[model samples]
Target: MSAIRHALTTKRADDFSAWYQEVISAADMAEESGVRGCMVIKPWGYGIWERIQRLMDDRIKAAGVQNCYFPIFIPLKNFEREASHVDGFAKEMAVVTHHRLIADGKGGLIPDPEAKLEEPLVVRPTSETIIGDAMARWIQSWRDLPLLTNQWANVVRWEMRTRMFLRTSEFLWQEGHTAHATREDALEETHRALEMYRACAEDDLALPVIAGEKPENERFPGAVETWSIEAMMQDGKALQAGTSHYLGTNFAHAAGIQYQDKEGGQQFCHTTSWGVSTRLIGGVIMTHGDDDGLRVPPRIAPHQVVIIPMLRETPEDEALLDYCEDLRKLVAAQAALGEPVRVLLDKKPGKAAAKRWDWVRKGAPLIVEVGPRDMAEGNVAVLRRDRLWNQDNGKPAFSFVSREDFSAQAPALLEAIQQALYDEARERRDANVTRGVTSMDQVAAHFADNHARPGWVEVQWSKPTSAALEAATEQLKALKLTIRNVPRDAEPADGTCIFTGAPATERILVARAY
Candidate 1:
C-alpha cells in the first residue's frame, strides 16, 4: 500500500553499475585515489578485506602450505625466461627503469637519465617466474618435491579500463605456488585449491559458484590446464572469482627447477599456482548487495552484529549506554559459525535513527537498537539486513524481543541470515541461466537486448582446437559473449556442437563477464 524509501539514491533495477558505485560510496567502503586506476580502501572496506584474509589464510595453512614473503620488485629477465608468461603480462607490467628522480629546469621532478638501471625491474604482477627460481635452488632431490608455499602481497598491472576492486591497477591477493615431482601430483593440488575456493566462496562469503575447467583460449597463458570458480552477479554477468592453474613443466623448464629422482636422473618439476584476490570483494558486492546496500555474510562481516543505543544526550542516556554495553558483551560471547560473534556498540555523537540507517547501508547482518523506553520495557528492536523490508506494510521488518531472548537467539539469527542470503543468490542464478540453447542463432537471440538482464547459456560444443577454437571464439565475440567454462558437473553432451554442427564432446557456459 506504501512505497518504501530505499537508502541508496541509485536503485539497482534502474542501473546496476551506478548502484554498485553508490553502495561503495554510501557505505564508506573505498574511493578513488588521486592516481588513475587506483583506490584508497577506507576503514570499512579494509576491515572486510582483513576478515577475508584471516579466513582464507586459515584454509591455506590447513592445506600444509607455508607462508612466505616475496619482493615486490621482480627482475624483468625473470619474466623474460618464460616467453609465454612474459608475453601475457608484458603490456600490463609496470617497469622501473630509473633508480632516482631529479629536479627538472621547470621545478618539477623527473626520472634522472643518469640513474638508469642496467635492466628494468617489473612490479610483481604474478610470482610464478620468480618463485620458480627459488624452487630451483631450494629443491635438490625427490624428497623436496611437493613444495607448497604462498605469499600475501600486492601486485601492479597497468589496467587501461578499471573499476574499484574489480579491475584496479593495483590490488592485493594471495598466490599459492607449488612444485611437484609428477603431473598427477600437480593436477591434484590444482583441484584441491579449486575445491578450497569453491568452499570458501560458497560457505564463507555466501557466494554460490560454478567450478569448472576453462577453455584453451581462457587458460592462463602458460598453463596446460586452468580452472576457475565463476559466480553470477545480480545483473546476470559472470565474475571469475578465483583461478587455479596446472602449469605442467612450463615454468620449471624455463627456470631450470630440476630435482634428482631416486635413480639419480634429473627431471623438470610440474608446478601449480592458484589465487583469489580483492576482486572477490567485488564479487561479494555484486552477488549479495541489494538496493539498500551490501548484506555482508556473518562469517565475513567485520562486525556481525552492531548495537546502537538510542541516546538523547540526557541524564537517561547514561542508563541506556550501560544497558547497550551489557547487551554487547552478551552477544560477543555467543558463538556463531564456529567463532565468537563480533558485535560493536555505537556510542558516538549522533541521533540513533541516523546511525541505524548508516549501519543499514553498510549491511550489518544484525542491528540492535535500544531506547530508554525499550530499556524500561526490557526489550530491544532487532533488524535483520537479509529481511529488511516488510512487503505488506512497506516498512523495515523490525522484530521486538525481550533482551534475554534476543541475546539467546543471536547465534541462530546470524547463521540464518547467512544461509538466507546464499539461498537467495543461488536461486536467482539458477533461474537466470538459460539451458537447451542448441544453436548459435538461439544464443544470439537470447542476449539481443542490452537493457535486459541476459544471463548465461549452457551449450554443447565439439571441443575444437587451434584454428577451430579461434573461430569459435570469434563467433561468440560477435555475439558479445565468451565461454565462461565447462562445468565439472555438467551432463555429458548428447547433441551436436552449436558452432560447427559436429558431434558435441562437452558443454560450456557462455556469458558476459566482468
Candidate 2:
C-alpha cells in the first residue's frame, strides 16, 4: 500500500470530527495559532480564501457597495446602543481596558494601572454597531440615503470552542453594510446580496446550497430578518455558508442614522448587512473532500494542475523534462472560465509517489506525470483528483490522453470536474432529504438514524405562538437539531407542526448544522 494512500487515518463516515482535523493537517491548510482560540491560515489555505475574496468582492461591487474599512474596536457605549445586539454578542466580546504598558521593577511589562481608559473598547465581533455609527455620520440627507459599503477585515469573537476555518477567536471576513431610504429598497438589497451568495457557492465553488431566511431563533442579532445559504456536507451536517441581514431601522434608530426627506421630514434609514468568512473554507473541505484526502472544487483550487517530471535522463530520455515544461506552459496559457488556468511544475526531488500524493492531499484538481515513455509516445499520464480512487487495485491508476488533446481540452476538463462534484453532492442531498414529516416520531427517526446521510428534513412550522414556539425550540435543541431556514418562496404546506399540533405554514428545513 502507498504511504500517501493512508494520509488520513480516520474515515469521514466513522469519525467525521477527527477526519476534518486530519484532512486539514494532511492538506496543510491551517494550524492552531499560539493564541488559544485563534488559527493561522497557511499559504495554501489563504490562497483559496484569496480566490473567494476576489470573486465575492467583484459581486459586491456589482451590487453598488464600495469597499471600505472600519475600526476594529468599538466603544463600549456604541455596542450598548442596541440592547439586543449587545445581549447577543456580550459573552463572546473581547474588551480592551488599558491604554499602555509599563516596565515593572522586576523587568516584566504589565498593563499600566494609571493608563486605564475611561471607556473600555470591545473588539468587534461584527461591524454592524461600529459601521452603524459611521453610517449615521455619513448620511445626513435624502441624497445620502443609500450608503452602500463593504469592508474586508478581521474580527475577534472570543468563541469558547474553536475549529480551524469554522469557528475561532479571530477570522478574516468581508462584511457589507448599507443604508436605504425606503424599507423596500433595503429588503431588495438584502435579497440581491443573498442571491449573489447563492451564485458564488453553487456556480463558483461548485457546492449546491439552499438560499432562505433564517428562523427567528437563528436570526442575526437585532436584524428584522436574516437570510442564509446552507450547504450539506458529506457527513450530513449543514454548514451555513453565508448570511445577509435586513436590519430594518433597529441599528439606524440605535445609532441615530436619521436622514432628512425631500419634504423636510426626518426619518431613520433602513439598513442591511451580509458577510461570508473563512468558514466557507470549512464548507469546501467537508463538501468535496473524500476519505483519501481533500478534493477542492476545480474553480477554487490554488493550482488547478500540477505536472511532475518523472525523469531518468539518459541521452534518449533527456527530452522528458523539456516535454513536461512545455506541457505546463500549454496548460497555463489556456483560459478556464476567463481566468488563466493555474498550473504548477513539481520538480522537487523525492519519491514520485510521495510527491504525487502531496498534490493530491492539497487537492490540486489534476496531476500529470511525464516520463521518457510518455515523451516517446507523445502523451501525458493524468490522475484526476476527483477520480483518484476509481481503480481496480492499490496500483496507481492513471488514464492517458494524447499531449495535443490534453492541452487543448484542459479548461473544459476542469469545468467537467467542477460539474461532477456538484452533481454528486446534489444527488446525495436530494437522496437523503425527507420531506413533509407529519409527526414528531418521524422527525425523531429521521434525525436519529445513523445508517445513512441525513442531509435535510423539512417540517411544516407553526405560525409561531410563544408557548408553542418555545416548546418546539427546546425540543429541537434537545435533539441536537436546528431549523436551517424557512425559505422565502417555499411552497405552502397544509400540515401542522411536528413538535406541536398547532396549524402550520410552509416547510422549514431542520438539521444538525456546523
Per-residue alpha-carbon lDDT of candidate 1 for residues 1-514, written as tens digits (9 for 90 to 100): 5899999999889989999999999889999899989999998889999999999999999999999998888999998888788779999989999999999989899999999999899999999988988999999999998899999999999999999999999999999999999999999999999999999999999999999999999989799999999999999999999999999999999999999999999999999999999999999999989889988999899999999998888998999999999899888889999999999998898998999999999999999999988999999999999999998899999999998899999999999999999999999999988999999888888988664778889999999999999999999999879999999999999999998999999999999999
The C-alpha stretches of model 2 lying farther than 4 A from their native spots are: 1-6, 312-318
TM-score for each predicted model, relative to the true structure: 0.99, 0.96
Each model's lDDT comes to 0.94, 0.87
Off by over 4 Å in 1: 449-451
Error of 1 at 280 (Å): 0.6
True lDDT of residue 320, candidate 2: 71
Q: Tell how far residue 235 is off in model 1, in angstroms.
A: 0.8
Task: Tell me, by lDDT, which candidate is best.
Answer: 1
Give the clashing residue pairs of candidate 2, or none: none
Displacement of residue 498 (Cα, Å) in model 1 is 1.0
lDDT of 2 at 221: 85
